[model samples]
Target: MQFAIENALPMLERTPQVIETMLYGLADEWIYSNEGGDTWTPVDIVAHLIHGEKTDWIPRTQVIMGEGSKTFVPFDMEGHHAVKKGKTMSQLLDEFKILRKENLAQLKTIDITEESLNRTGIHPILGTVTLRHLLAAWVVHDLTHIHQLSRVMAKQYYDAVGPWVQFMGVLGGKR
Candidate 1:
């Protein structure tokens, strides 16, 4: 389907609530453990999402909208590790919710249109990108993490699932 602001907002707006619902009040093992070897735990994913909210989406949109420099600031992918150190998952989720709400509200205030969505900005690595591409990416980025969160959480039961492992794609094909 084509990207449309009307369709994108529901997914963007509901992402935090979906994340919070899936993760909040879970055991630490589910919240903090990873798929091993540098993969993110749910906590890390939440922090990364929070970081993207504060840095990537609307900020880049502003640049595309001609509100600031045409060239985008290079995003710090690992910057959230430091921010996550002292905070609990609950705190991170709350921060994400608030930031997303604010960003979506700010988005509503912008005079975005089909024509405007074609406006371009220079990505640090990818060269020129349109506003529509950025917005579509923002939605997909949220989805990618959400899928990662589910896969990571499911792997917590990887070994416990026993012979059913062959049926489970998330456990790396049953180890």
Candidate 2:
């Protein structure tokens, strides 16, 4: 769990940097593409990350600390995307960065002893799960979405450069 939290810090920092460098000034049309087969826009991805930090990581940690309920509410990804679609990419990215920083700070202060690891919560879908499990999943979730963002970015690059760019042979196959 400590490893997961430590590893997540740099990735969290990189997320905002990637958004600002690669995704800034991109139109909503580019963001909301169907090219990725129902994959979310970059903005939606940011919102999902933010929401996960807020509704999943932080709250679950609070539950572990005995400051909140053990009952975990299942998240609605589609619903989150729908609500997030209204925001500009910059707004979403900013929110994600801020929330991630706050969460990281909070994580650093947590005491993850054997007792904390034994802390359990009632996940709406998975029934009861330990704090360690929750923390591990939080790290997994970050990695999963970072990979998702990379795929989306790759698709965008391929689309922008057109068919012949595929022949440029960086990826050695169809873009």
Candidate 3:
């Protein structure tokens, strides 16, 4: 419901640092491990975030800002594996941080106003979209992934929690 770009930018700005602090010094095994099949490893999650930073947020903003007639391309959720191949986990983290910084810098330079925020564009999947909504989603997307990465990392000790797992909402997936 919030449309203040000033407020949302802080969230986007700190995501990389938050994630880095969370996952730093963990073993390579932990970074690349998941509970089992059909789940994302921490590494995969970071790759997905990087993919969004590249293709989703900034590009769509441009479309809504002035290129409303342009079609917003559908984002590939898991396609970055091939495109981002050969990158180490560290590289992905660093790249995400760099790209996010660039995007935030550009966002700050723009003339954002109520009229600009209300501008609309056509999304391939979501139909017509507004700049405000797109910017809001961009903030939420980073947060969701950060939470997901935390959950996956916490699940590494899912069984280790023993009987207390019943009371542990994170392990129980209650939240």
Candidate 4:
């Protein structure tokens, strides 16, 4: 299989754009709620994306470039939250956007050869995995978080507009 930069860059660019579009106009209170009792506030989700790019994707790419070892470092999302708790939602989102851009830039520089994709790395839990698997999973991770953000937004909309005609219209309910 061909490991081409052309195939990957567009997907990387789309991830942050999708998140930003999905999150437009949401209020701070709604964004920060623990609706599902999960520790991740909306800001935390943004922070998680930023942190994943730094800790997960960058290091993996370094390994692929033969500049670093494949030994994975465990990441604590809750620990990230504690550090990021001071940040405003917009702040976290801005930081995430910047980091995502950097990730895309770094990815573009990678020499995407079949041999590079086939290079193996030992993830602490998953054991050995190829560069392609890591890169694909990074995109999947972005999509997963985008879906999570959308779900939270949808629930907030449902709560705010419950069973009314306007709510029906908002949800594309036909008369």
TM-score of each: 0.95, 0.74, 0.93, 0.81
- 138, model 4: CA deviation in Å? 0.7
Q: Which ten residues in a row have the lowest lDDT in candidate 1?
A: 166-175
What tens-digit string does per-residue lDDT give for candidate 4 at 63-134?
766755776676666555654768776776677788889888877787778888888888878898888888
The residue ranges of model 1 lying beyond 4 angstroms of the native Cα positions read 172-175
Cα lDDT tens digits, model 1, 1-175, are 9999999999999999999999998889899999999989999999999888889999999898876578999999997897688999899999999999999999999898999999999998999999999999999999999999989999889889998988887776744
Q: List the residue pairs that clash in candidate 1.
A: none
lDDT of 3 by residue, 70-151 (tens): 6788888777786458978778888888999998998888899999988888888889888898999988888898878877
Report backbone clashes per prediction. 0, 0, 0, 0
Candidate 2 displacement at residue 29 in angstroms: 5.6
Instruction: For candidate 1, give the lDDT.
Output: 0.92
Which predicted model would earn the best TM-score? 1
What local distance difference test score does each model get?
Answer: 0.92, 0.70, 0.84, 0.73
TM-score of 4: 0.81
Clashes of 3: 0
Rank list by lDDT: 1, 3, 4, 2
